[model samples]
Target chain A: MRGDLPAPSAAQIDIVEVGPRDGLQNESRVWPTEDKISLIGEAIAYGAKRIEVASFVNPRRVPQMADAEAVVAGCANAPGVTRIGLALNLRGAERALATGIEQVGAVAVASDAFGIRNQGQDRAESVGIAAGIVEMARRSGRSAQVTIAVAFGCPFEGAVDRALVIDIARALAAAQPVEIALADTIGIAGPGEVAALVAEVRTAVAPLPVRVHFHDTRNTANANIWAAVQAGASVADASLGGLGGCPFAAQAPGTAAGNIATEDMIYMLHRSGIGTGIDESRLYRAGRWLDRKLKGSSRSKVLVALPPGS
Target chain B: MRGDLPAPSAAQIDIVEVGPRDGLQNESRVWPTEDKISLIGEAIAYGAKRIEVASFVNPRRVPQMADAEAVVAGCANAPGVTRIGLALNLRGAERALATGIEQVGAVAVASDAFGIRNQGQDRAESVGIAAGIVEMARRSGRSAQVTIAVAFGCPFEGAVDRALVIDIARALAAAQPVEIALADTIGIAGPGEVAALVAEVRTAVAPLPVRVHFHDTRNTANANIWAAVQAGASVADASLGGLGGCPFAAQAPGTAAGNIATEDMIYMLHRSGIGTGIDESRLYRAGRWLDRKLKGSSRSKVLVALPPGS
Candidate 1:
């Protein structure tokens, strides 16, 4: 029975805090550069070893990340933490490398419809661009990772093909990125599908780590994250206060389609005897801080439901 | 290897719609008797075969359920549906049988602190009363099932012991109730804990179906529900629009700590190829109707994020 499956063998799973970048990028209100830096500092203080500090997208398209260089430079003093910058193409990759960010996150889309709308590229073109970005980062002596977005389902194209995702993983693996990630960009995946896909992707990118990213549009993000971890995913991405939504992804008019909350993820993981090396109490405080800064209640249940001291 | 576990062998899982009873009981705003009957009728039309139409508790304590008898009488003519009534003791069980409801749902608490606060009885006394209610229902030629509440964790006592839950399950199984249920009354269980406990409880009550209930207080309810189903639970309880929370369970002020939404559960189950026999589209309509009647938005993500026709 699945219940009897051995507990996750890894003593600790790496959590990639994406609050500063992905979490803030989707909000209509653009946060100041100082607040972004403070968010990263708080995350580091809460024991987040890997964090996505900013994305190197076009300023006009993603004005929320317009101060990426300033944000990246502000956090350069932090020691013993891997700062990541998300990039969709070689131009963004060059910009990220220019900032001396520790890691470059290259994104590839699994569907042509989403790819065209999201980054003005087709599926094949997106994969090639992501691979080129990885190669550029490697030449610059920085680590790079590839994330296949809409790997599970696409809002515009509907069901994404698993074979297409596998093919993308294999092609990206040749570039020898640090890991391959499968992203439920639309939050349309169930646990079974996540387990099967993560397992297949892990096999496809042998020896390379598997990371998982999920949106909570359908309220299955935590379950999908747990399923991915159980299927051998070693790293997962979450945002503080569950503050994120893809600006391009279709959603209800006023609903905040956020990612799985970082605090909630840590709570589930730590309570299950799984090590995340992240402090739950501190994350709760950080969530509250972010909520206050945004003048909005946190989308994370733990932050709202449980006191930080608890 | 866990991913390879065969899909749920059961072709169909029973979903006991608890919106009318558990859903409305927690809300401060009392829904009229006609609205309660309309909710039940809509649920039946949405293909829910079993429903908890009302509860026979103290009208003064749970004024939202003050019209229990009227709701029961209004729904009595519905055929092919097992109408369930919740009761905490023998007197309530007698009232349930007197109303000609199909099943009596007796609730037992696993923790003394929560048990006493929730139903004016401690752990041992609550189990004894639950067993007595089951016996009373059996004597009246009616079906009865016992639900062990706070089996995962308690608000006042914190972590509940697995041994205690198993003992209660064994005690309830001896009464030969139709099934045994474990409820996360305060929504504090992780997937790992849920899987292990459900497996143990299923073993203790061999051949008697295991039903699972959860509140999304901490955003782990869907994950926990999926884990329970994977661990061999044959039945689940959900509310329309995710419209239920324990009146006695501690929660964040102003936050709706509702149960897993019936539409969300159906979406996950049916998408994974497990049959729920419930129509997701109709559930969306029902959710919207409930939202309008209550003058509040649904707690269900699927209803808010996806269009009804989608």
Candidate 2:
């Protein structure tokens, strides 16, 4: 039971696979575009309906995602999949829309410190950028989603103000995006913080579906996800094999920053009786394939735990 | 809030350190007794009031714990530390008491299948053995704690009945041990299961303190701990570096069975505004030391996230 709030909006949650976009973007390895397409196809085969397949950022800024157009063009027409592309500006959004992707994900950081460092803009400027992208997507007849990065905490600015985040959500919601996702970019959040923030954001953006992107840096991502679900989040983001992290957040020493492993989250959600409509065995197979391609950098324990026969 | 139960009993929790005993027992490396003692000493230095330092099982069964006597002799007298030793039978209990350890941890399997496989006894026989150990500890004027293994689920028997676990708790509580710990031996439990079962068991054994021992085999241990805490569990068990599982449980392919990492749990609890009274930096230091000694098998993310200077 979610604390003093309505139960989760949906019994069946849509787990958006973010490995192709978020997971591979932070890796040191620049995977071949075919390999990236194969990974996205594998996720689709394993029952990923909503997938963030690529980021249309500058090729020099993020060389790993340089093939965003190619990747989207390759995987945009997968059967029964809603292909998503990340966009930080109108140009990126137009590029993504040109590829026939279904959804464009625009992002704005909560703090000016992070916004300037990450996107060369202040908080207000980044929000304006995201709003323009959302408007463009809507005018072009494509759906859009906005994510608030470091909604819980930030490395550049340390503790982010909740009131500031709520205000940002309110502004982002004003543009009427299809969904608003709150990202714990540094993986420092616990359940209480997630619950309180999601409740406030849900109220601020009435009727707009809220999602969460959690990092397992401190091993609290699963708990944070449960709390977010309890707080009425309908969609959750994860990376296959626990791959991915923000490049800016990787400067810290010994950081185990990664998205929650898709298979691991599926294990917990399935066991808890929450429906994700994702196939666990197929997901595991995808993870095994990813692990081999990534040369065992995957931090997912479930991939190693469920050996072939049992 | 715990579903249909009283609020948690305490604002602060006493986390029981179990790295030296449970963590080492599953490892192939037979650590030197001095290293074991130093680890225990480090836990004490880090404000662990209660620690499971050693086990007095047969050397032939668990060669890793063969230095139990030496480990106890070295760390049992640490000031203000309640040193605990695991005892599977009356003989082990007597050996633990002889070393002047403050408490003996006696365990009983909730399922007959697990009982026979793990201890070569049926459920009733294992309970009988545990009861004898508890009674002996009581007579010797030393405190005893009873752990119900596989209280949530069993690998061999599959899903364990909550009624059966409630019955086992009733039986163990009847022996009047100081604390009754319910262990998620196979790590299949989710927060909902944990909250529901803990609520039932807390009712079954009123006034007998309930502690939870969680395994992160499925990446749900942190959430399970939060559920257990909400259900009025005041004491939680964890290993220092996420380093231990049942030797018997390790035979299965992909059995990523290890106790919740103490540092990770502390990070969650502390960040949630719950007090553990343990020094975080010291805990990280000990983890780093253990990671170097154990050849870096420690599964703790916090150790890697928080570098020496950070």
Candidate 3:
């Protein structure tokens, strides 16, 4: 069996499935709420303990997330699974809390240029807004994960400063959210940069768990992820079938606008001897099902390369 | 630009282009001799100091490489470039040397099953043949590099033992070839396995100048390469446009029958602050040319993702 690898490192990492929210938000095809819920269930079956099911954003701006409440309602109460909902502001946080999900996710862009372009706020203003959401989640006895978008690079402002990212992460660290995620919003980070930033953030935030969100735009995300894990960041975000990327940043031809594929990550993590309770076979099936639902081929190399059942 | 990154480690690594030999050998479409020679020239212009141009295998078995001498005659004698010709045995090595190429490459499979299947010899017998080839190259004042095929996994015989790979490396170390390469022929290796094996092999054969050859079969090639480099392997093999895989192992579905793309590896290496001497724009153009010649898309993510002049 291909799964029979040399004993891997003893680190067990958690992959938070973000396809339903981050993936669907950018897809050209808006899957129905029912199909969206079904996809989340499939991810859960593939050993996704924490899943971001929907984003509680304005329906007018993001029509794909129009049925966020309904999607959450369908997936929130799964036994032992931590259902997450993304909230862009305090109102979005309230909406997420209303669904009774335990975790609320929000974004804080690192670059001022990307902050205004993506969220109509400057870096400080965006961090302030995210702080409000994180505070609201805490008051409601819910955990919050504030992801610093463009932490590695920006589309509008190229070459985001490492010090700027670290400063913003430090400021967010004061909010004491359950986790702080550094996102390679444009997928321009290599493993060296990732390791440097993760080490800095891990030291800055200390006990606050550091998570990473990577887009495989340049095909360096897997190596970047390995580097991050080696640098003490335990959590990462992945999409089924390697689906989803920031729509604005994905306009370039053949840009991999997707997060790393769940099955592909599972394979790497498992073979590295890092425990990720995921079932590889089930994850492969999820990728296949996602491909059919999207009416296109998946970007996942493993899903395409390996035949079913090894 | 996507090129600005933290000061990369002060390590300059060598990327040996294998597209012409390992890549074209397995390609279903046999590129014309002129096109093959042109590709080698393009790789040279893209800053490939070491290029593997052809293999002296039986023309009947690998008809694509039948014009090895012609191909070398065109690429050899290029200023500051080392042309390599792969030979499976002394006869092959002699043929390679006759082409006036300074380097003769050979293979020594780690698994007995793959050894028998690929070279019609068992592991010990194949190592003996490779030793003889090395001896011939040494007497002729030609450099030889013996790549241990299926160093990580084998298609016919799965899960090659680590001890067996180390044992093979130890045996070959006595021959004192110019370089020893560990090839993940089936691309089933992960970063942990790669680190472990490279560490063991580096210790087993100090100062042998360890090199790595990876196929992106499981989407873990980049990570594996990263791990290998971290563990002190300074040389890696890549194919232009991510071309080539072992034809024998590529029959399976979704098998990555190609080595990592040269342009993609250059991108990662350069961004990591590891200088590869490869001009990214020139490499991209080469990939574009390769795609056109092959009448298919280039498998390089960086080549396809970014637009011109980015």
Backbone Cα, N, C clashes tallied per candidate:
0, 2, 7
Error (Å) of candidate 1 at residue B184 is: 0.4
lDDT of 1 by residue, A1-310 (tens): 2233347545578899998988888887898999999999989989899999999999999999999999999997578899999999889999999997999999999999889988999999999999999999999999998899988877777788888899999999999899999998877888888888888989999999999998888788888888888789999999998887632234643223578899889888877778888877788878888889867667887776775455
| Cα shift from native, residue B127, model 3 (Å) | 0.7
What are the per-residue Cα lDDT tens digits for candidate 3 across A1-310? 3344455433788889988888888787788989998999898888898998999988988898999999988775778888889987788888889987888888998888877867677999999999888888888898888999988777776788888888888888888788889998777788988988998898988888899998877778899999899888989899998878532345552233868888788888888889878888888888888988867567777876765554
Q: Candidate 1, what DockQ?
A: 0.46
Clashing pairs in 3: A8-A272, A8-A273, A305-B254, B8-B273, B244-B257, B244-B258, B245-B257
**Model 1: CAPRI class:** acceptable
lDDT of 2 by residue, A1-310 (tens): 2221122334678899999988888787898999999999999989999899999989999899999888888775877788889998788888898888988999998888878777787899999999889888888888888999988887877788888888999998989898888999889887767877888899999899899999888889999888788778989999999888632344562232678999888887777767899988889889889989978766676776674554
* DockQ rank order: 3, 1, 2
Between candidates 1 and 3, name the one with more favorable lDDT.
1
TM-score of 2: 0.94
Please give the lDDT score at residue B12 for candidate 2. Answer: 83
Clashing pairs in 2: A254-B304, A305-B254
Candidate 2 chain B: 10-residue stretch with minimal lDDT: B1-10
Model 1, B145-231: lDDT tens digits are 889998887777777778889999999999989999999877778888888888988999999999999888778888888888888
The TM-score measured for candidate 1 stands at 0.95
In candidate 1 the C-alpha lDDT for residue A180 amounts to: 96
Predictions in order: lDDT: 0.84, 0.83, 0.83
Evaluate residue B140 in candidate 3 and report its C-alpha lDDT on the 0 to 100 scale: 90
Number of the candidate with higher TM-score, 2 or 3: 3
Candidate 3: segments with Cα more than 4 A from true spot: A1-10, A245-256, A308-310, B1-10, B245-256
